[model samples]
Target chain A: MRRAAVSTLLWAYAAVALLPLLIMVWNSFRTDQELVVEPLGLPHSPSLDAYREAWVEASFSTYFLNSVLVTTLSVLLSTAVSLLAAYALARSRSRLMAVIEQVFVSGLMMPVFLMIVPIFYLLDTIGLASTRTGLILVYSAVSIPFSVFVLATFLRQLPVDLEDAARIDGAGPLRTFWSVLLPLVRPAVATVVVFRFVPIWNDFFYPLILVRDRARYTLPVGLTTFFGEYQTSWSTLFAGLVIATLPLVVLFLVATRQIVAGLTAGMGR
Target chain B: MNRRRTAALPTPVALLFLLPAAALFAVFVLYPMATALTYSLFSWRGTAQDAFVGPANFVALFTTEPYATQLPRAFGHNALLFAGAMVVQNSVGLLLAYALHHRGRLRRLFQVLYTMPYLVSPLVVGYLWSLLLSPLFGPVNAALRAVGLDAVARPWLGDPDTALWVVVLVTAWQWVGFPLLVYGAALGALDPAIEEAAMLDGASSRQRFWHVTLPLLMPVIGTVSVLTFIFSMEAFPIPYALGGSSGSPAGATDVMSLLFYRTAFHSGASNAIGISSAVAIVLFVVIVGISVLFTQWFRRVERRLT
Candidate 1:
């Protein structure tokens, strides 16, 4: 009886969480009026009109492409920069490592709003504000600390004997880092990629501040343009939302273990 | 083993990796923080030139008629959101984590489901929930009718009075799983026999939980709370996505971060950078104070626990 009760509560909470999602998907497949009238019931006649409207009317394609570009570049840059820094910190074992550690930790906690004016002024001074590259730089800088934390744990746990073995085999430090340590940290690297991608993909803040032109809009900020002055067509907005959300959700469902392992890197062990 | 390597790298290679991160952080973090401090003292425009206005800006921020209305509301709104998240998010998280601590067949399934909302973009969440809570034709209203609770229908995110709480509810829903998993990991590391002994005693489940489990959960709780507090102060996207930063319905949902954003950069405005930097500086000091206090508390808890 207790077991049954527990499962029932579990299922109910799951239902509460998933129900809104289901409603979004369902509404996107129906007429807006139909969604309003019989929202709790199955769709009377589903259609592809919302997706069509979102694409043709909303210019979602531009935003989607922008998201793809920004996500790819930011994740690549941040992960590359942090990986080298983390490897150096791991191997060298200097007091400067403590400074590096402190810098990243505070960066992690430092609210992005606190730096908005200065960064904007500086970016604008350099002629990069309101551009995709500017957003990419900001994303990379903000993401470094946590990525370092994740990579540091994994790299520290890595056996130094592997490097010793490679060095004795006549590999230099750089070559040993590549041939020996890099292969072992593939999971950590994937973690960094997804970690940066999901946030940059869905981010509305920096884009809202940085990107001025609608032509340069990323997905999340572009989706808001459809909201209008008062109300949006609910069905069409839902379609736009689903398209924007699906990539990360699909990736997450497939790689649940890696994400969890990354999040709980030190704590789990 | 020397291929010209003696405990270091050639300068160019070291600079190659470090330069990008260092340059960005310098321009963004260090200079911005310093700029915020200087900007807060005087009135200035987008450019470097400024007028020496002394502490007039600080005095104006306090004694000005408009700020009187703004400050209390911003702090109050954030506090309500913070308290709501602490109760709803952390408690639900602890319960879920406790229930799912053992790795059973359904473990992976629940984990994914719990973390699913977290993965969705915050903008989508704000959009999705506002749609769900729409009074005219939302499914929530339909479900309320189906369940014969029509009288409980609410304006939800629409009304000025209830809008902030609606944001808080959604925020809690999205973020709770994080703390739960953090605590769950810590709990999994604890020796089971100690908990078993307490349970085997004459103590009730409640007694054992309070006298034993809650105390043991303190360290993780401390760490998680500090993280949550910092996050809560910085959490702008959901509210911004929901009602917007200037806030809807007479700025009812405005937080300090949003206020600063609006003041500094109003939809690609050409100027107002200096004024916005001043607001951000005040925000920085507030954040630094809170984080330092939490760090001290975390250390105290750490020392006591260990």
Candidate 2:
């Protein structure tokens, strides 16, 4: 009886969690008139009209490309820089290194809102404002604190025998990090990538504020504008949402275990 | 544990490794934050810095007409969001985690299902909920009317009184997966022997959970609280997506970030930069200050546990 109750509860909660997205995806294939007539009914006849409209007419293609560029570039840039910084912090024992680590760690608490206004001006001053390059830089910089924290913690906990072996093999520091230690910390790197990728991909704030040109707008911004413009066209909006969300959903489906491991690592301790 | 291995990487090489991150952080993050601080002190005339106001903007923020009222009201909404999330979201997460911990069947699938919404953008989540709760043709109202509960069907997002709470519920719906995953992991890592011993001592399952399990999970609880608090205070996308930048329905769902956005960008006020910078500074201090307090308290709790 208890087991039955538990299973039922879990299944119910699961439905609550997933039914909205399922409904949204389901209804995207239906026309807006069908939706207004029967909000809960299955699509009478599935069509790709909504998808085509969102993609071709609404310019989701451009937003999708911009999102891909910005998210990939920022994630790669931040992860690389954070890896080096994490390695330095992990391998060093000096007071200066400790202070530097603290500086980076303190950034983990720095609110983006606090820096956004100033960042706008600063980027404008440097002539990078409203540019993808500027948004990428901001994304990379904001991501540093958490990425470094996670990577450094992971690196510190690693066994030192690998580094020692590399040293005896006549490998210098860079070589050891690149060839020896880097391979071992692939999971940690993956963790950082997974965590950072979601936020940068999903972020609406920075893109909304930083980028002005419609051509350069990311998906989140584009989706909002699309919704505003097509307020009466529910199916098209749903299609746009599916387009915006499908990549992350696919990513989650593929990397569920890695993402959970990344989130839960060092969590309980 | 080898000191020699630690010392092998010379300081210069270590510094070299750190330089890129340091430079990016300094220029982009640190410099911008410092500039925000400086910007708060000056009056602005349409993006150009005017005479140094020296806290005059802050004075207007706390003492003037619209801001004076809006600041407290928005902060209150944030507080309500934090409290609501704690009560509704985290507790549900804890219960769900406990169940999933005890019942292992389809656990991996459940984890994925629960966390999927969290992985998506808050803007998307907000929009999704808005559609679900739309009174005109939303399925929720449709189902209600179908079931003969037509009176219960109303414009959820359009009502001022219910708007903020709806945002909170939607937020909880989106993020409950986070605490579930965190707490599930924590529960998994727990040593079963202690609970077993407590059971042997004539403790009920409830007693064992309260006395043995709850105390042990306090630190993780604290960490989750701090994160929830920070996120709640910094909430923007949900309210923005749901209520628009003005946090409409007569500003019922207005939040600090939205207020700041309007002040800085949309309001076209003379001192938009200065006043908005002050708002940002206040938000920064509130988040950082309360987080520090929570962290200190969590350390105390951990120390006591040990």
Candidate 3:
């Protein structure tokens, strides 16, 4: 009886947890009138009209493309740069490297709130503001600390013999890092990519502040404007929200173990 | 192992490898932090500082009208959210972790389901809850009324009294999955031999958990606490989405991050940049203070446990 009660509780919470998503998927096909009249019921006749409308009318395509471009570039650049730095930090036997690694790790605690104003100014001064390149640079920069943390730790655990072998073969520092350490830390690279992708895609604050053009708005920021403009259209707004969220959800579903492991990897042994 | 062979790679090579990350960090993170500090010290109109404010911006946060009135109230809301997360979210996650710790297949299944919402964008979560809590068509109100408790059904995100709490619950709901997984992993990693020893000592289940399992999980708990506090301090999306950027429904849901965002970008108030920078500094100090405190606490606990 006790075991049954415990299982029941777990199952109940699981149901609660999944309910909103199920509702979202369900209501995206629903009309606003249907939603108001029978909010608890599944859609009697599901339609893709909301998705179509949100796509064409709400300009999610522009926002979607911008997000993809920014996230892909940012993650790729950040992870690659971090791999080099992580290689140096992990393989080196110097106090300076140790201190640099510590500084990078400590960067994890620095909130974007403190840096947003200055970053805006800095980008504006460099004439990169309101451009995808500017946003990409900002994303990559912000992501460096955490990626370096993960990558450095992963690289540190790897046996030093491979790099030694590469060195004996007369490989340069860049060659040794690329050929030896990079392949070995592929798992951490994937982890960093997945970890960084979600936030950059979902980020609203920077986009809201940095991007002056509506054409440059990422999905989250665009979706907020959509929410504000179409406040009354529940169905379309749900569609937009669903569209905005679907990529990360799909990524999480496909890479559940990696995402979970990557995130919790820092919780200590 | 030739020390001289490894040394041949040289400092320049390492420095070359460090250049890109160093450049990016220097430009974006370090410089910006220094800029925020400097900007906080001056009275600025738009992008240009006109006079040396000398801590006046920070002082004005307390002495002024909208800021002074809103700052404490916002902090109160943040404290309430923090408390709710610690007490409620942590407890739920802990209980779930304990119940599912040994369930194998069921545990993995629950882990996936519980963490599903967390992976969804916070903006989406905010929209979902606001829709779910809408008085007219939301399922929450519908379900409440259907169950014959119409009196308690509310415009959860629309009322001043209930808006902050609703946002708190949404924030907790989105994040509780994190601690659940962390605790589950920690519990799974506990030594089976220790658990067996505890059982063989004639300890009841409760005693076994409290005396053995709980003590061992202190490090993870501490880590999760600090993480929770930092994330909560920087929390912006959910409240911004549900309550609007002004932390609306009468600023009941206003947080420091939201306040800073508005002051700097949206407010258009005079010297808003300086004041907002001051707010950012406060947030930074709070986060750093909490992280250091928690790390020290975790070390002490680990030392005691050993």
For residues B181-284, what per-residue lDDT tens digits would candidate 2 score against the true structure? 99999999999999889988999978887788888888888888998999999999999988999888999999999999999999989889999989999998
Which digits, one per residue and each the tens of the lDDT, describe model 3 over residues B234-299?
888898888888898889889988888888888888788989988888878877887898799789
Candidate 2: pairs in clash: none
Candidate with the larger DockQ of 2 and 3: 2
Model 1 off-target regions past 4 Å? A93-101, A267-269, B1-17, B46-48, B267-271, B298-306
Candidate 1 displacement at residue A178 in angstroms: 2.2
lDDT of each: 0.75, 0.90, 0.85
- How much TM-score does chain B earn in each model? 0.86, 0.95, 0.94
Classify candidate 3 by CAPRI docking class.
medium
**Candidate 3: residue A174 lDDT (0-100):** 79
Residues B1-306, candidate 1, lDDT per residue (tens digit)?
333223344444544555566666666667766666676666665565568777766666666545557766776777777777789756777777766764465876777777777778877988888888888787877788899998877877778988888888898888776776677777777788988898788777678767787777777787777767776777787888778777775778888777777766663433355455556666667767986897897778767755
lDDT string, candidate 1, A1-269, tens digits: 15676677667777767777887888889888887668776767888898998877788888888998998898898888788877776665456655866776677766577676667777888899889998888888888887877887787777676667677788876787788878899988988887777888988888887888898999888977877622647788889988898788778877778777655545642
**Pairs with backbone N, CA or C atoms under 3 Å apart (clashes), candidate 1:** none
**Candidate 1 structure, TM-score to reference:** 0.91
* lDDT of model 2 at position A154: 91
Q: Report the error of model 2 at residue B122, Å.
A: 0.4
Which residue pairs show backbone clashes in model 3?
none
Q: Stretches of candidate 2 above 4 Å error?
A: B1-3, B297-306
